[model samples]
Target: MILETFKHFPDFELLDSGNGYRLERWGAYRLARPDPQAIWEHQLADAEWKKADAIFNSKWQVKTSVSQPWPIRFPLPLKAGEAKTGEWSIKLLARLSTFKHTGIFAEQAANWEWLTEQVQNTEFKAQKEQLKILNLFGYTGAATILLAKLGCFVTHVDASKPAITWAKENQIANNLPNDSIRWILDDAAKFVKRELKRGAKYDGILMDPPAFGHAPSGRTWKFAEDFPRLLADCTELLSTNAKFLLVNAYATNSSAIALQNLLEDSIKKTGTLESGELCLKQNSGRLISTGIFGRWSK
Candidate 1:
């Protein structure tokens, strides 16, 4: 499996990288933010960083338009703080704007294209048979929407109400069939346990486990301590003719080798395993390893 490859991102650019930070352009917004992973030194002038529309402090927020009256301090709501608006179009009720994000991990684009092809080519002989796919930790539902667009009956699970709501808004914005997907706001592990108890099975499963996060009710999810058990239980939830299982990790504790080892120990025992790191090419044409991904297929 290829861990890092040169992939083209038509709409995004990694403008600069240095000082434990990165300058990025998404659609029409230019942002400067802290990226612990970007350890390189800046090759550009200081003026370049000053030109960002927004800069991150302890957290993220919008920068006042240079032409507008500058407020002494900007007080933004939590959700608003994490978002940035640009001229770009999005699939959510939230106005079509460049998001606070640098464009959805640009590296995951490869996975998106791969999965779409997989679902499109794999056929089930049963009449009225539909591919049952599940996406855990589905942040904004980009993959969920994409899979649904390809005729999969997707169940998208996330613990954050706003995130789920955002995903739903994106689905609606895209005019997706209301019946094509199911949105659930619950702890992913807990939901999987319940699904197992209910004897539910999925043909395909995708998960992007966060390095550290908490559920709505304060349930902590520390990937290192929990992922193994989670993966073990998830294997039980796969159907007899399961198509694929994908796991993506971005935390420092979760390396490409570690993820591959876990998949080999867990899913490989049941089927074939494929794994690698996901990477992005900066504007300077440098490859940046962003995340790790693994897959198992029967």
Candidate 2:
């Protein structure tokens, strides 16, 4: 039972969490957001929780104590700095969203680190083969930018125009090359089908599908009904030398074992499969489960 948790994120922290709410620090700003998994009692004092610059209320409204849309910088790994000044960084625009999201998932930082290591390994680099990565539902482009920065060609697909635009902005904010990523705004399933038809392939594939969503054209995406089909289609797009496939689901009724079964059934490839909960360690030393994930790698 490997619990994938992000404890090394320099720009993010789970300061405190309890009482169906969480207090976190994203870069320099503190925010309070709802988390149904924090079903325990608050460990931090009321004064500490009040230190948040903004709080998302039950009505999906943000109550801010300061002006929003601030800037945050995340320190990147050494591999990501090789192309830069030996100290790579990523800039993000943080604001309170209606969905209680801060434009980034800190827990996925662990996955980013894992992906970087996989592509940077000596064996992979010795092959001198440029890796191609596909990122489905790549909101805000965090992983896409990191992969592109690592010299891999990335295809970033998202159904929301605003999310795609935000991801592009993050790319520019980090000064990533314009051609490093190919941005696609379309339904995930439709795009996969198109790629399969064109005989396209990728070395790595990542997806974080919502429990329920609607495409830009109002096409419904119900996880229970669509995920199996999507995974099967994605398997067809994998390159012969495919290195990895990662699936992440948040706040869904599906379990990590379910995701593992889905991948095991669809990929039909020999690889190491690891499945577990993605959690955030609160200041109380308690792990707050946020999502479930299944990762396959060679």
Candidate 3:
């Protein structure tokens, strides 16, 4: 499996990881949080770690006074050979969650760049001016905005109302076209079933599911029990000329290879398939592996 790390990143930094916690710098503020993957001795001094603006140990321990939601910008430079050559900026809001999340998964920056390329360099771009995308579990709308800014109409679905609200805030903050994104707050599996019945099609489909999730309709999502059937249904929703499918999983017992295997069994279209771990690099040159992903593209 390949190990992918973010490049051209300055809005976020992984300063250190050790003692089951990670010290990070998000734009202007610094934060420290629990990291299960950092099972080694710390490279930075404890005093340095203690100076975090916000620390989360079971609950947030605030130190320095900070804004309720701060702005962080991600610069996504297009790769060579794309129709567009300049970089695009993705602006998002950063807020500490009760569950120790900052509303941004910086490690997925690599995949975001790949998504940019797929949009700008698609063989179907000439035939299809606006590539349609379905983003399930679309937290905070980072990828959603990226695709929309590149002239794609995106349907962003998430179970959390607050997440969808936050994502909408980010969209307005960036001054994007209001018609570019369609926001849906519902259970991913149930929504997908409805889309399939309506004979809806998407050029690309992406999801980043939590280990367990609860929907507004009182439906619960268990990855192990619900993911396989969801994947099968997602494949059927893909257009015959689909461009890509991406799946991201965190805090799961399953491996990236397992995701690849499931996609192999689920996808009927022949395409290039790859699976790997997504990681962040610390200042000390060590990598903190965060999650795994399986991506397929034509």
Clash count of each predicted structure = 3, 0, 0
Error of 2 at 40 (Å): 1.0
lDDT of 1 by residue, 1-298 (tens): 6756434344557788888888876545567877778888887789988888777766555674532211111111112223545422323222212333532455676777667656755656235688999899998787887778666899999998877776787787667889999999999999999999999999999999898878878989999888888898887888887888989888647777788888887774466677788877676776677888888776
Candidate 2 lDDT for residue 196:
94
What's the lDDT for candidate 3? Answer: 0.89
Q: In angstroms, how far off is 87's CA in candidate 2?
A: 2.2
Best by TM-score: 3
True lDDT of residue 14, candidate 3: 92
- lDDT for residue 207 in candidate 2, whole number 0-100: 95
Candidate 2: minimum summed lDDT over ten consecutive residues — where? Answer: 58-67
**Candidate number with the higher TM-score (1 or 2):** 2
Q: Rank by TM-score, descending? A: 3, 2, 1
Model 3: how far is 219 from its true place, Å?
1.5
How many clashing residue pairs, candidate 2? 0
Tens digits of per-residue lDDT for model 2 on 198-236?
999999999999999889899999999999999999988
Residue 82, model 3: lDDT of 48
TM-score of each: 0.81, 0.93, 0.94
What lDDT is reached at residue 286 by model 2?
81
